[model samples]
Target chain A: MSGVKQRVPQIILTVVALLLIASAFVARPEGGSAPLGPRLLAIADQEFATWFSILAVFAFLMGGLNLVATHLAKIRERGPDRFYSLVTLVSFLVVLVIGTAKLGGPPGLQGDVTAPGSWLTAVFDAVLSPLHATLYSLLAFYIASASYRAFRARSLESSLLLGSALVVLLGRIPAGRHLTAWIPEPLAFLRVEELSLWILRVPNTAGQRALMIGIALGVIALAVRMIAGVEKDPRSGGDGS
Target chain B: MSGWFAPGTWNIALVGAFVCAVIVFSVIRSRRGAMVAVRPLPPLLALDRAVADAVAGGRPVYFVAGSQDLDNMQTVAALAVLRPLARKVAEAGGRLFVPTNRSLVMDNAREICRRAYLDAGRADLWRDDWVAYISDDHLGFVARVDGLIARERPGLCVLMGFFASESLLLAEGGHHVGAVQIAGTASAVQLPFLVASCDHVLLGEELFAAGASLEGDAARLGSLRGQDLCKLAAAACLVAGSLVATLADVTGAQPWLFLRDAFLNVFRAG
Candidate 1:
């Protein structure tokens, strides 16, 4: 009985996966076409999509609850980081209350939580947006530091990387264009801008495309393993069958 | 026929079916004791060293499953890699912390770590607080992680999954704290940032392959082999297509053009 019970979920998963794959391949019936199979598959696909959206809402709720619980525990422990936890809880509750009550909007639950003058909108625009922007701006400094370390011509690969990066960076500016303006028309292809464009369009694109293809193949293999029930469920934690 | 297979998608269906068949066959062969070997990934080795260092240093190991939800395949791959790492941390008697942006992922991550500890006979060391649900806001999550890294000063930081701009922040934060960092993602745009900042980085499909290699399971290894075969086939097609297209462009031959289009049509959507 226990074995049977365990197999049931696997069976359901396999069936659902197969059905979804079939649905994706089979076209829906057109006007006045009475194919029952394709129509049924299409409906199943739509239903699954709907179910997923519903599940996503619940997942967010669960996440919100977990966040609350975690912060509460931290506050109760009076740890060194309890102050940060308290700030997070306060921020979360303020946003949640303002958004739920539709405060400072048209004054009803039906009003938009993000209406221009609403408290939620103000919080988002005045606080959250600036914070997001500030954090994003930090990437510039991080990039400079990372580039300093990576662009050092220590080896053959690093030399190539440094050379190409130099060309690409310099090629984008007016100085690079002026530097190469003395070259004859016949040798224009060797100009910095042209070289940079060729590098980006040819080798860079080719490498990116090859990587994408490899990633796609990997995804397919993983999906096949999952649909075939060969993958060990992390929840089960079994030495894979 | 149109109703049987969607327009512009039949080619995809054919490819999908072929790939699925190949993977399934390989998996069956593996289950039947066929030998499969995976090339060593340095990032995974670095991950092992990181765990050992954390254990020796008595500092926690932090695993960041980038700011992506469970629906993303990259996130799934991240979780796959996490299972083995968690098990290692558990057996080594080292602390492991996972901060996630998605609740669903947080739940799954907690389960994986719990099972790992249980399997290692260290369930008592597993704490619910180990996997915390961070904020859903992108930068907010990064800020919290930055703070965690600064405060805790973890010895090892393993980042795997889909990341956007925050990839740099997380990696740089780890770098500043002198943590041994191993990062992996299939996102091509983010790969350069990680490679530059991380101690070791897994490029593209290597992230997926890392998970399979770490599992050391025949079935997953077989699937990895099958994926390689598909990549070879794809490369052949690309070379052939490029050659035919180039010849058509140079020669202005009708037959060459026809052949090129015919070949390209097999892969193109309607």
Candidate 2:
């Protein structure tokens, strides 16, 4: 009895997953030509997708509560990072109030929260956008630092990578094309641009495709394990049987 | 037939079923005591070491589940790895912090961590705040996590899952903090950044295999074996198809062309 009770939830999960998969693959003919089964499956798929979206919205709400609780605890503790937590809380509340109330919009709750000149819109454009852009700008410096480390000719592989990087970098510029312009038409493939293109189109593409195929197979296997209930359920909090 | 399968998807359905059958069969066989072996993944070993070191040194271990939501397959695989690692950390009395950008992922991660601690018989050590949602905004999450990494200076940073442009910032942040970083993701675009910045990297499908490799259990190993078999079959098909297509193109042979088209139609959607 205990085992059966434990298996109940897993059975339900598996059934729902199988239903979703079947609905996704099964065909639905157009208009009245569609059979009842396929048509029902299509409707079930749409309903399930909608249900998932609704659940996601609820999850978002739960996350907001979690964020508030966490920052509030930090503030209560008077830790060194309490000030930042306070700022986060205040900003969250301000945005939530502004967006929900549709403040600074045309008027009334019917006005769009993100309408021009709205408080939320101003906050997004003036504060959030700039902050996002500033963080994004840091990527340039990070890339430079990463490249410096990656391009060091410490090993054969690194040397090859460095050589390829140099070719790809130079081939993208007009100077590289000019340098190779003197080459005969019969030897045009030896030009920097041609070589770079070949390197990208051939070896690079092949490697990426191989990786993609491997990843795809991995995904399929993992999905099978999950659907078959062979994998451990993290929510159960116990080691696998 | 068209009415029984979605247009342009019958081939996909057939392939999906075949893959599923292969994986399921392998799993059942292994469960019945069939032997399965997987190649060693160095990053998983490094991860174990990092956890032990953190426990001994009384420092925190940071786990970043990347910027993707739980819906992503990569996030599922990342969470799978987190289960054993979290349990190990909890058992050894080491602090593990997981900062997530997506709310759903954060919730799922918290459950996983909580379960880990419970299984370790150290439920008291589990804290809901350990897996916190920073922000859904990409850069905002990165900035906050970067600050956290700098301030905490964790001994180990385990970055696993799907990441985008912020991959380097996070990895470099760990590097600057002198943390032993182990990063894994299937994102081709970000692999280079991770390879450059982390101590150990799991490239592409290796991320998916990490959990199974760490677990070393029959079912998981069998699944891994199943994936390998599928990969071999795919390679064989690719080679055969290429040969047939090339012969048809070079020789303008009607028989070769027919054979190639028949083979292609078996795999081609619609």
Candidate 3:
């Protein structure tokens, strides 16, 4: 574990050096206009981006290692949920080996890991994809349950929330139009569909845009803080986790 | 060698200037601890009361840190938020239940909770049983989370993170359990479910801004101001673009074309 951890700092320093060097030379200049330093930096940045992506891959491997260690320890200790640990480890190793080994090689060794008609592909498509989709779809049921309890018409704000929810909900459905169809063309602006559009487009969009502005600022601040290496941590500053 | 005016060189220079200005602005602002104006949610207070009740009622505070791994900005912001929240929960003598979808997230959540408890002077309240790592299988995580919400019947459920479809599910379950549900996520796609279900929904960037807003740290607030400046720049560009278009419409001079070209120059390919 220490051996594995040692590589991270080295990698970080290498990446910083690469980025700094590359920042000098940018990318291909229009009209063959790039100066030597900028051109070199641009090229370096491209190479850096290409190579640095591997860090994510390594992190994934690290995740797998952590998973293996934890689960194995769980199984050994006969922990309260040892069976689940075994299940996690089995699933992880199965995915790892199959994905990497390209079991059956799909259409022989030359094929991509996820090539169509392959076992790996099948497992992912049949198992992983639907599994992900199913988990994602759970939101639908959750929304229904959460909304029923939270959206009670208790007070003014709650009532307003209910009203907005209704507008947004009705606007998303055809029934909004079915009910509001009697309104004349001139007065159609008051229709649920139109109102929904206004709510999403005006207030929602405006609000989203405003938040984006704030987020961008926060990111900049975070980046600056990280670069300057501020040691403050809300948690005990050890590890800054 | 191409002169500084060469399109590529000029664009880089412009970007450099922009970056430098932002950096300078942020550096200065971070040093001057400033408070940002944040809209207080009266409903959020109601939410706190509801959560307190749930805890008093012997239910847990079910918190989901979204499905994202730690690297995501939304996740980091979520962690920042969880600090204060975990503190508040501990201070209230409530049990905080965090069921994470990712193993790394699970570890981080535990560390965060540990720190929070320590900070709140209730380190003893922290327990391994509280922060559990469910399966990474997204659906499995949701099912397990859903089950916990049902079984534990937490007094308050807070789901904050970079969620996808699971946002609706988690919030809904919390609501069903009669927990005070306050949810926040930066993912626009999941906002509908959250907006519909959660008692207090922090919209879009507010999720990021709220952490800084709540902390009232000058550096964070300055960053907020920097973002405002960035937005101003964007708005200025939009207004300028519109004005040029309007003038071009009247004068038949196509002023917008030049403005567009200028904008492109700023954003032009390397």
Candidate 1 lDDT by residue in tens digits, A119-233: 9989999999999998899999999999999999999999999999999987899898888989999999999999999899999999999899988988888778777777777
Report the error of model 1 at residue B74, Å.
0.7
Question: How well is each residue in B130-236 modelled by candidate 1, as lDDT tens digits?
Answer: 99999888899999999999999999999998999999999999999999999999999999999999989988888877778887889989999888878888888
Give me the runs in candidate 1 sitting further than 4 Å from their true place.
Answer: A1-5, A32-34, B249-258
TM-score of chain B of 3: 0.85
Clashing pairs in 1: none
Clashing pairs for predicted structure model 2, backbone only:
none
TM-score of each model, in listed order: 0.96, 0.96, 0.71
Question: How many backbone clashes does every candidate have?
Answer: 0, 0, 13
- lDDT, candidate 2, A133-190, per-residue tens: 8888888988998899989999999999999989888789999889889999999999
Q: Write the per-residue lDDT of candidate 2 for residues B109-203, one digit (tens) a residue.
A: 99889888988999998888999999988788899999999998999999999999989989989988889999999999999999998989998
**Runs in model 2 with CA error above 4 Å?**
A1-6
- Which parts of model 3 are misplaced by more than 4 Å? A1-25, A29-34, A43-52, A68-118, A125-137, A145-204, A230-241, B1-62, B86-137, B225-270
Q: Per lDDT, what order, best first?
A: 1, 2, 3
Q: Once model 1 is optimally superposed onto the true structure by TM-score, how far is the C-alpha of residue A212 displaced, in angstroms?
A: 0.3
DockQ of 2: 0.76
The CAPRI classification for model 1 reads as medium
Task: List the global CA lDDT of all models.
Answer: 0.89, 0.88, 0.69
